[model samples]
Target chain A: MKRGTLKSRLAPVALLAGLLLALPGAPLRAAELDAEQQARYQTLINELRCLVCQNQTIADSNAPLAADLRQQVETQIRAGRSDAEIKRYLTDRYGDFVLYRPPFKAKTWLLWGGPFVVLLIALGVALRFVRARRAAPAATAVDAAALRQVLADEAGDDARRPPENRS
Target chain B: MRLRYLVPALVLIGLVVLFAVGLRHDPREVPSPLIGKPAPAFSLAVLGAPQQTYTLADLKGRPVLVNFFASWCAACRVEHPFLMQLAAQGVEIVGVDYKDTDADGADWLARHGNPYRTVIADPQGAMGLDWGVYGAPETFVLDTAGTIVYKQIGPLSEAVWRERVAPLLQGAKP
Candidate 1:
């Protein structure tokens, strides 16, 4: 019984190890980012798109351009540049197209606000649906007998009600 | 039933929009900084034909296509026929041999039936970096004023040359 529990616990760990082993390609070489810098850089890279590949973010891509961008980010971090400054520098060199989360200005409002606008419309439709469903019962007539019984039950539940009111 | 049809219709519209955005992107027309800028000057000698030298100064009066290639490059081989076609169309072509031996460049040219008017050797790739060449077989089209108007990063196809380069030769601004 004890062995069974141990086997069940070890099974997932073994399975995970096997899966990692089955994956092709060697692991990426880890750069020297401290805990604070690592989190910051990770967040930054996730936001920045790889210029060459365009579709993939620098954090997710293994292209040479992505690697160069990663190194540039690390170097910038070590030099004490803020995230905003770094992003600005990259955008200046590679255009607004390089950014995955494009800036909120004249041209990119459509990209930024499109999803929220869609979500708001969806919410409005859902609310209307629920409201219409709630009003559906009102459109149908209630049974008189059932309504009377409900009223009687309510009257009986009150401590001030007499036995005649229970009916 | 109406909502079901509406869902599919919405999905279809979304898919169409997605496809439209995907296909709308013109990767080939990504503007080069070299556009409207003067071609970098170089007076390198043609490797095999030692007597012939190529320079930006010489190509000042007419449209010239500077094609950077290497004998060892596979993409350059793919573009060989297109280069020949361009030559057949009476396009003046200059070649920059990137990091290749003189004998190999000459033999490769001999085998490929040399399409270039002049070929210069850049065995160290110094000139290549100066011209912002990350890889081989990049072609730059220079106008009469010696300004680089178009830069194609990969092997140029006959269709691509006709679509992108030929118009520029006919006096298109970019």
Candidate 2:
């Protein structure tokens, strides 16, 4: 179905979280260092999203496909593939959706940049509001009757005074 | 003053429009990256008939529909009859039973009335990985050149067959 495609990739909040997770890190030992390789396994699985369960990472999902993908990831890790290479393997088949952390690419520019854009707009509006407040004095409402009373009192005072003084 | 209210209101409208449009989409249905690329290479024996085999290279001369199904997948059952209908109409379909035992797959097809021209077994689903299959009941349509023209993530209903797949098979836009 050629449904009208309107992606509400509105959550740059999630993107920010994913960004921290996706940041490049040190290389792993080639299938030998058991402890660090296991650590790397944990990190890789956590970062890779399960396509079947959309929200859950492969580490977290019980879906058969997720399990299979997890196995694939582990196999590749033991083969000494780098994290980026492993991610590339998935993104090749599944597109960028398999990564919990989306890559900074053409399609995802809005997703990564949307929060900062909103922040800038908000900051611009606040700056304009602050400058406007600083530039103008508060216009207090002047009651018409109070203005008339003041005028009448001044006039009466003028009448009571001598002609030269009034002039 | 009105513009101040109007700005937020416009932003709210934009959000509503976006979410409303988003609601119509099936999020689970991931569009395959394999589309517009050649179908993945594989050679697996037909489900019941192990002596015979099918491969991606063999499917090159004409348009074909490659469907991945399994005995365990309930969604595949829903689309089985329509697939049979297509088969009756001489639509060349290659059925790959993803992560299914040959015994169960053959029995399922026999009971359900085999719709496939040839049925292949993918007990481990390694070929599923190659084809970018995340779930069962995924279908891929290949052009005469064997390039994957389109991929249907879920069930292939008659409406989808008529509206989308049929036209594309004829080299026209749906």
Candidate 3:
């Protein structure tokens, strides 16, 4: 019985090990580049948005299109294309949507400055709230004495009342 | 209402309106910047006809409809008949067989009537990449000057052809 339980437990682990072993090893490295070329290639891919997988950069995406684009970027880099030139080439074909950081233009003004505008508006509101809170105490300070008098009068009335009336 | 509160309320309304408008349109339908710009230059050999080459220069001086297709793409099959109909209507359609095997592309064209004036074999999708074709069945309408005037990202329906493409072709000098 002990042997049976041990075998059952080992079976899953063995299967898991087998599955892990079956998985393809490290990704294939197709290109040999110097450190500078590698760095530039990395930066370019990181900056480029994968059109197929909208959320991921080309470097991070596993989509076939992303792989093709990575190859294209590598080729462009090897061909001594400037980063700007490479970006311009991609933008010309895929439009500005393929860029992670879109250029500042007339149409993109809202996209670029929208957050700051919202932040400023939020700060203005917050400032107004703080000012209102600060000003509120000043207005209530005059009523403090009157409120104390009212409380004292109530206490005196309570003392004068019979036990049954208090009840 | 106080002006202070009114301004925020107005801003909120404006934001809501903007979001509503944004929501109405499909985000995937990004307008191509190539529209109104000159078509990308490419010189590819005609599929199955290695001797004949189709260059962008050949497309100049005449309006052309460039259609990207693949045998593996189901949508391409769906649009094949319409493309044939357009070809029958005297539309000069150029085909880009994207990333497809030569044999399969030839067989596909044979099975489906070849509606293209010349089908360029883009086995590695090099030309398709230059043309910015994300998916198959993308069609572009170029004016006589080889300027891309209109682009349809999906399969071309009769309605789209009659409404959008026909008008553009009519405006172009035959």
Candidate 4:
């Protein structure tokens, strides 16, 4: 057999063997989740912040606190609690820091609304400049021509009419 | 004009100065949640004396410093000498063995020379959470009232202990 064909045939098997070897210490019969609950739990965990570790979502952090929080979520899921309830339970225990998207409040108003306000102000300023340029003499020549036509019509009316008494 | 640029330039410098001043505000000075509040309840078996249980109530009415550690935690080993120094200074030091076997914890204590008054074993790590521990080698300083006055995350340096704890020891709010 050609070496290339042999190596190609062996690659997938070797990968499978490596994967099996890597999981030797893993527990048999690992916790199983129903499809619906598994998807909900995954989405919930991805949104949650790992309070103990900096810059890691709860799903990603390996910190003990993160593990506890993850287990707590799993327990809530097993209990048939909704995702909101699970998040509320964790936030209650760990404070607002546990939330990745902080709730809009007096202190957090700027955090939530600052970007939109900045965009609106930028758009307003841009529109003002655009309007100003459009209103400039070169662009407003059409309006200037209309004004000239009105003035010329008045001059023609005066010339056509018998001269009004000098006033 | 050059002076127009100077105004924004000065404003930028002023903002930089303000930001620098804001950055210097230390989180350690913020009163810890564990301060003035009852120490969280914990009951873990003693690492060396396995049959005995170490509870938070056991250390009430005394100034105790609980050091959370693990045999595999390198920072814990780094700060071991500082803990010994704290012990020598008449501060009663207790240890919490975090997620480590009692045998390994005992061996580590023996090898490093134990400065702990009692070493609590948290083999399953339930007790560590009760104390709001994030990682290994976090030290909590408690007052005579059993309230946790300060918590030092990561390795405890002498400078941090002195700057953050000595004032609290002198009866100031952390």
Candidate 5:
């Protein structure tokens, strides 16, 4: 609900919104921080993975490990450590998996480019469908007026025949 | 018949194969970056004897097993007996009581029987964080050179010890 001070932290709307909805109770440490420092603190915790749960970020998880990680972030912030330094400290120990954003490296080339690859393939398929439809010959139109006249004449001829004569 | 007709089907299969691989991979087991790197240096008081301290340097030049555990963790209980078996066979295991109270940790070990060569109290879990521990029952195998070689994320089973760990310890230059 407190989105005013946390706009920067909530930049990735869908990820943060889902995480915040799942966020249980208040966060672990409401460590005293100024406006700018608090914003920085929120950003770090929100982005860092809670390794215990594996799915939830430290900001959303109720795991004790998440709490400890949050506390660590706050402590580092108070110590005047930069955001990059704090992140590097964690990634150094926990690997790049600890960060929600996987680093754009050789190993993650697929992960980074996968969506666009899928999109391109889909576009190609769509284009092919459109082109195939364009190339296909159209069907000949039916003569509706002639068809109605023929049916009417058939009905009249059938009526003109008497019961014995019709046989 | 044409290659373009098969492209979408091929893409669909590729997606399925990628997802299947992801499914097979265990998310709980985070691949440790510390592997092939020297173990993090730590100096913590030994459980039940705060006066004495154990450090990473003490375990150098020998294959060592550093186990992260807590009385609060259920999985640690599962591996306790197996750990005792390893210790009986002269395996030196260093137990780090991660993020647990002194009373509970000591009591739990006393009840279960101590299997560790040296049980260090990591009350605040600062050492655990330094070791990049997110959960209990994590085990790390250090080579003779003090480089972390293997890390097991959960409770040890007899099979894991017999197959993976025992072989690594043998390969470790004594």
Candidate 6:
């Protein structure tokens, strides 16, 4: 009974795994790549963005264009093109947008640095706010003293009143 | 001290304005880098007549408008009449039936009134990749020297043809 239950549970998982593997644009049957080439292939695909499905990497997209691009990448890899050459080839044709991680350059300096610049500005503002708040306690202390004096004067006025008026 | 909060508020408002402006423009209309560069070479079979092959070299030494289209694309159908008009006006238009079956492409051209001087078949879209074509109904205006002068991303309209492409062709002649 235990064995049967386990097999039944494994069946759907195995079927799902098969469906995932059969998805279009998923890497085809493993090519005869050595360890180094395999690593490079993974890196290249992950770095390249799919133009059709802008949100996905070429490796992750199921679009026909992505499949074609993958085939092109594999062909280039087989042709002994270096990783840099392949990246340059795609970028030259498709522009820098095809890269998931765009290169740091003069034009892209703002894209790369804008976040850090904003963060720094925010930090400066927050620091100033904290410092100002810290310094505000002194002013608040003077206000508290005035409040205490008012309370004492109110108490004196109440004490000076007649017992019937107090009642 | 209150002004410190104003800095972030202003930045946020500025970003919101920038995003609003950006939303007005089509994000799919990425400018091609191939403009002002030499057109990519291609040798593809004619759509109906597979025996005859058309090459990019055959149309050299003259301005040619290369259009990429597919039977499956609705925008291509919409642009068909404009292309036919341009062809009638003595414009040499080279058609690339991108990633479409030969029979479907041939049928579409016949039904829509073929506008191309010569039609090439890119069954696998291999040549389309060389030209960095992301979608269908893209048109490129190549100068006499085989340099790509201008590219239009969407379906062609009469206004666009008159405003942008007409001047380029006239400028190319003498």
Docking class of 2: medium
lDDT (0 to 1) per candidate: 0.78, 0.85, 0.86, 0.76, 0.88, 0.87
Itemize residue pairs with steric clashes in candidate 5: none
Residue A161, model 6: lDDT of: 57
lDDT of 6 by residue, B9-110 (tens): 998999999999999988787678899999998888988888998887876799999999999999999999988888888888999999999999999988
The CA-based lDDT of model 4 is what? 0.76
Q: How do the residues B67-147 of candidate 3 rate in per-residue lDDT, one tens digit apiece?
A: 999999999989999999888988889999998988999999999889998899999889878988877889999999999
TM-score of each: 0.58, 0.79, 0.82, 0.69, 0.81, 0.82
What's the TM-score of candidate 5 when only chain A is evaluated? 0.67
Which regions in candidate 5 have their CA more than 4 angstroms from the true location?
A1-24, A27-30, A138-167, B2-16
Q: Which residue runs does candidate 2 get wrong by more than 4 Å?
A: A1-33, A138-167, B172-174
User: Where is model 4 more than 4 Å wrong at Cα?
Assistant: A1-40, A51-53, A61-65, A76-95, A120-167, B1-11, B14-36, B172-174
Q: Model 3: runs farther than 4 Å from truth?
A: A1-30, A136-167, B2-16
lDDT by residue (A11-130, candidate 2, tens digit) is 576788799779653233224548887888889888988998899888877788888887888888888899899998888899999988898999999999999999999999999999
B12-65: candidate 4 lDDT, tens digit per residue: 998999899989974323223455567878777787676888787897877778
The positional error of residue B113 in candidate 1, measured at the CA in angstroms, is: 3.2
Interface root-mean-square deviation, candidate 2: 0.7
Expressed as tens digits, the lDDT of each residue in B1-174 for candidate 5 is: 688668778879988998999899987888998998999999999999999998989889889899999999999999999999888888889899999988999999999999898899999999999988888999999998889988999998899987888788776533
Q: Model 1, A42-152: lDDT tens per residue?
A: 788888877567678887777655766777777787788999988876764455766787779997897889899999989998998899898775556888997887776
Instruction: Name the candidate that leads on DockQ.
Output: 5
| TM-score of the first chain of model 1 | 0.56
* Candidate no. 5 TM-score: 0.81
lDDT of 6: 0.87
- Give the i-RMS of model 3 in Å: 1.0
Q: Report the lDDT of model 5 for residue A114.
A: 89
In angstroms, give how far residue A102 of model 6 lies from its true place: 0.6
Candidate order (lDDT): 5, 6, 3, 2, 1, 4
